[model samples]
Target chain A: MTAAAGTARAVWRRPPLIRNPRLRWAIYGGSLVYLVLAFASVDVNWTRVYEGLDRGLRFVEGFLVPDFVSRWGDIAQGMQESLTMTVTATVVGIMVSVPIGIGAARNIAPLPIYLACRGIIALSRSFQEIIIAILFVAMFGFGPFAGFLTLSFATIGFLAKLLAEDIEDIDEAQAEAIRSTGAGWWQVVNYGIQPQVMPRLIGLSLYRLDINFRESSVIGIVGAGGIGATLNTAMDRYEYDSAAAILILIIVIVMLAEYGSSIIRQRVQ
Target chain B: MLRLQNLTKTYRTGDRALNGVSLTVEPGQVVGLIGPSGAGKSTLIRCINRLVEPSSGQVTLGDTALTGLGHGSLRRARRRIGMIFQEYALVERLTVMENVLSGRLGYVGFWRSFFRKFPPDAVSKAYALLDRVGLSDHVDKRADALSGGQRQRVGIARALAQDPDLLLVDEPTASLDPKTSRQIMRLIVEICDERGLPAIINIHDVALAQSFVRRIIGLKSGEVVFDGAPNELTDAVLTRIYGEEDWSATIRPVDEESDDQVDDPDAEAEHHGPAEVLDRERMAGLS
Candidate 1:
């Protein structure tokens, strides 16, 4: 009985994942060496950084004494344009994406349709919003029209790809049950697929709206039109206080949008 | 009448799920299909509805040949064939009334169904079916909110909403407790009897199948091995159907269903090990 108790109390240790010690050590040593080499290649301009400290301090002080009263007209107009672009672009992009997203889902659509939809998504996603904004600005001249097109295009790629993946990953058994009922293709999609992905689709659209608003502020730096245009003009004129006020307004709007979207998302879920 | 002549299904992965299987069901007949896991019971049922397209076979219901129909015809054909699933595959997000009404999707137009607007006839029938299933109070409840037996009852209501001539019931009670399982089986059999609707129930439990079904068809590795009345399922016959096991305890007389006392711990132990009981008795006698 004593021996049996001793046997039951046998010690256990977790097995090692990497069986080859040399290979493991070699990989660790190689990563450390590469990291050190990568870090050493960086160049820093200490004198330039020191010289810019006073300018940075002025920028920081501008926030303390914001010139919102002077540039209130410009700020309000820019906010309106940004909000308009965000709303229209989001609505239009969502409308276009719904069909494309359905087509791209492997389980739902035919092989050819899936391929074409995926290709379109890939093309839209490859270019950054700033790059697309630059192209559209060149094509249509500098204004919110260019910004709208860019944001709408970017929204398509983001919304459609995620929506397609969600559709692909849906409960097959639910869809199968619907299909077994002799539901037509449209009927199956309306009942089986829509209900499953509605919440996610709403959540994603809200997220994209938030994203497009932030992006509208940015693309304006390239003269695509928004608050970023006003911000750029202030920067050019060295009106740091006005620039700070515009930045603060942009931040406040984005925060409100995010909070509102989150609340709405919670309600839907 | 429904007939499947030379029905076969070979999946994309080259797995022969069903091979040259054929069977027929007369009007108002309740057939129980018994098989081990992966023995093509599911594939066979799915083929009849053309949900899993049969590689080579003919599925005939009444005078219509179901296999070669175009998209429009197929949808119309599917409306007449009701199916009940094991997991009670109710759309979790939809309400019970909506789920039940989804059965009439093939019959209704796209716009009508989409707006949650069924014809008054369909709406009244849905309400009646819900009441019949003892879920009149829960019509507005989301399908995900129901218990196992209740969810299955809703599934039955949905299938009945189609007013299907033929019913394909796949493992209707697989995920339920023993009593719930029995209740579901009894309900299905009673419903079939009442409406004179033919049904094919793919079941796992041999005894449960024996207890409820009028006729049995045993599938062994994608082929039919036994098709006969429940009483003809002797020990050797069961051995032929389900490889081999000490099936004495598994088999029971149909009238012995009053033996819910079988759930008693004493009876369970006795059924499990007769040798142990005999040895204990012998030891007691010697002592």
Candidate 2:
């Protein structure tokens, strides 16, 4: 036992997980205190949870045999609307983002233009897509058009920020060479900036298209038009099987989109 | 004719890259600029086309004052001046043909170039330039797919496509093997001679510069240390430019005329170690 204790003592003399023992102790003590406080402040309604157990089981049971056929018309129309919104929003968003992205890159654009484009990106990114959809629905009277506008604005923010960062990271020497050829600003962008970002741009656009589709379903809960509206209505009417069917459809479509995007990205890269 | 008066550049970081340098080059005259690293060779070459904006200077190419020209006019003036970079600087993603055609960006409009719908004459000229640079077979190949020498050829072709009055070559052979460097230098000097286009080649190898250029300008600490005929770039002048080096030991032999100096058995015997070190250093620097 003394031999074993000596070996253990030698091991303990070595460095702890953190180099500083005091800091390590402080982190451990602080986490333990926080965990205790969190456990102490717990609140629960056991009776209510017990009462809802059967309802939760019934909701889970509906997934075993989803009624996809009874609500086929609603599901199909909602999916079509979602698809349209996704396509339109992604296309318009990409088109608008390209110029704004170029303008936002500090290496390329002048200061004022860079600042303004960045301001637009920040403003759009600051709000949630559903929030934007809500505001647009109030303005445009609730439809896929409002959803389209909301997703388009969100896509612009996402795409432009990534595109600007990609532009900024490209080889400045290549652009300098173009500029030295007496090329104008537009010509420099065409020959210099565009080629470097093309593959990434293609990949990002496809990814954004996938995202806009997912967001399209969410926006419909606010009556902005899509599969979410149908899913919400079915759930409100206690048609859990129909709601399950809608969710399965969303999952399948999202999976297909993800697979498609990966294939396209591989080809481009 | 090209002229520079008191060209100076003090960068934002307070590094004075070029200090009140002045020089002139007549039409069709090929001059080599020799200097150590950070000796303002690049700054001088870039300053000619106003790529590195001079804090205070006057750059007159023929009749136009290049230093004071606005964006549009500066670009127009830049069209007449072609620059070759050390790293080739060809757009890697573009094809050789497209990269070469981009040189004519000054002449063509945005939509035309964007669609790759260059005029027939421009296309033919680009082909001719490619043929001259000996890359006619690789026109469809992407720029990044090319070897170093081939890329430099594409760079040269692109520069030539601009139809520039003056060519500014910055360390054109820095990244090339010694033999490849010689070939590239030969090609550049030959092209310049054929077209009667005046050029300024910034080179590191003094031996190469001695072989190619009739006139040499040596810069040290951003100032002109020596300016004379290539024959005048002796061991003493090199010492003045590069500082504290045994010139006779490190200096590489030039052409047949310098055979006597190179054939010195005793000097070669004494400097063999330092020569190897210099060669290793040079190779390391090149890589």
Candidate 3:
């Protein structure tokens, strides 16, 4: 017994094994492995990079004049179409999403309805805007309508999910008190649910509108009507200067939408 | 008048919140329910309104059987039975006047309520209730801005706005200080007396309940352990209700006047003759 006690004491006195190593070594090892694989797999020819840089410099030098003087009419038309599609999609998406988002919130809706709405949102979010635009273009024969539909689905996915989360986090005490007044389900939703979620919903919708504007420029590449259709055609014909001008215009529009949406969001919040 | 006959509520997890509890409240009588935490006091009050539905029971308010009713009928029945919560349960974002007017939502149409077009009588009654609750000047203030005592006053006004025949208050003073608790209890008693409304109040403060209510119902572990007049509530009864003998030390009468004089700016400012008389009346009602 004395021998066993001494052994137990010695065991207790011994220092424990350190369980964790410094995570920085793991990061360094991963980076070294990635560098080794990259260097081993890639055919890094310096001559090709130099030639590409020269071509890029020549392209930039050619676009010094911007070429807007001749293509102003087409550029203006494309800008208008893009703006129209963005606004229409955002408004319609917001209108549809309010109900769908409320229905998807588990706290607000029944189990089956919440699950179905969540599934719909998941399906809408799974596809990229370009892929959705391609499908709509094939079905609706390639027009601004197709782009509008694609952006609407995308907007519903993002905005509705955010709005549902906001609804779910609302103060349930207010809802309970309202229900205690013998108010119907609709009345509870209108008075209790709407006031809490409205401000957040407005802010999210404005942010989604800005995102939809940027997406609208690209969806047109899939034969959906917007500035991207013109951009793609210019690129196909090797009109690099015209395509560069269109790219600059698209950037300007996106910047303006971002600023406008920021102001609206600040006001709402 | 309200009566709960053999009411019991067993949750899905098989925990019995209320087990075969029965009680009665006569018109214009304020009965106080006292119990330790998890003794089913809140459950008893909630079951009266069917807010938390009882597993099995008959809760009858006058002529209507509150239990086993359809959803629509239950809702309509709930309008006549006003309930006050421990946390006030006012919609914090809404104005005090709007919170008071919410009491009449049962009678208003959905479209009218959505547009905030309450009837003229409802608006005037809400204004009167605000005045009665001493919140007339704060009608437009948000409910979240009110202090605990003021919020409970708003809660009382909101329940009174329902023109209820039965008032069920669950821990209305639980979150308040002793002074504020006394004031809230006084207000409850005064309102019930003035309107001839029957009420059942649940509280953890045995002394406060004994002072304010004529009848006391003590609960323990989901059962009614003691039911008698407040005068008959002895230390032994408290021990039986709480499952301990050490709570007698905590049941002494509190110095409410000094506490009120220190914290309440309004009470301090109104320290003149009529206010002192009013305070005495409040104290008498509380005791």
Q: What is the DockQ of each candidate?
A: 0.38, 0.40, 0.37
lDDT of 1 by residue, B1-287 (tens): 99999988776667787788889999999999987767778778888888778889899999999999988899899999999987888998999999999999988889999999999999999999999889999999999999999999999999999999999998887777777877888899999999999999988777777788879999987899899998778788778877787777766665575636333333222212222322222122211
Candidate 3 lDDT, B1-287, residue by residue in tens: 78889999886657687899988888888889887777777777778887677889899999999998898899899899888877788888788988888888899999999888999999999999999989988999988899999998998988888889988887787677777888899899998899998899987776677667878899987899998887677768888887765553444333332323333333222212222322222122211
List fnat per candidate, in order.
0.82, 0.85, 0.62
Clashing pairs in 2: none
Which CAPRI level is candidate 3? Answer: acceptable
Poorly placed runs, candidate 1 (over 4 Å)? A1-13, B254-287
Clash pairs (backbone) in predicted model 3:
none
- Model 2, C-alpha of B276: deviation from truth (Å): 25
Rank by DockQ (best first): 2, 1, 3
Model 3 per-residue lDDT at A257:
74
Evaluate model 1 with DockQ and give the value: 0.38
Candidate 3: stretches off by over 4 Å: A1-48, A58-67, A237-244, B253-287
CAPRI verdict on model 2?
acceptable
Instruction: Compose the digit string of candidate 1's lDDT tens values, residues A1-269.
Output: 85877765568777767779898898889999999999998888899999899899999999899999888898888888888988999999999999999999988898999999999999999999999999999999998999999999999999999999999888766787888888988988999989999999999999999999999999999989988888888888899999999999889988998999899999986
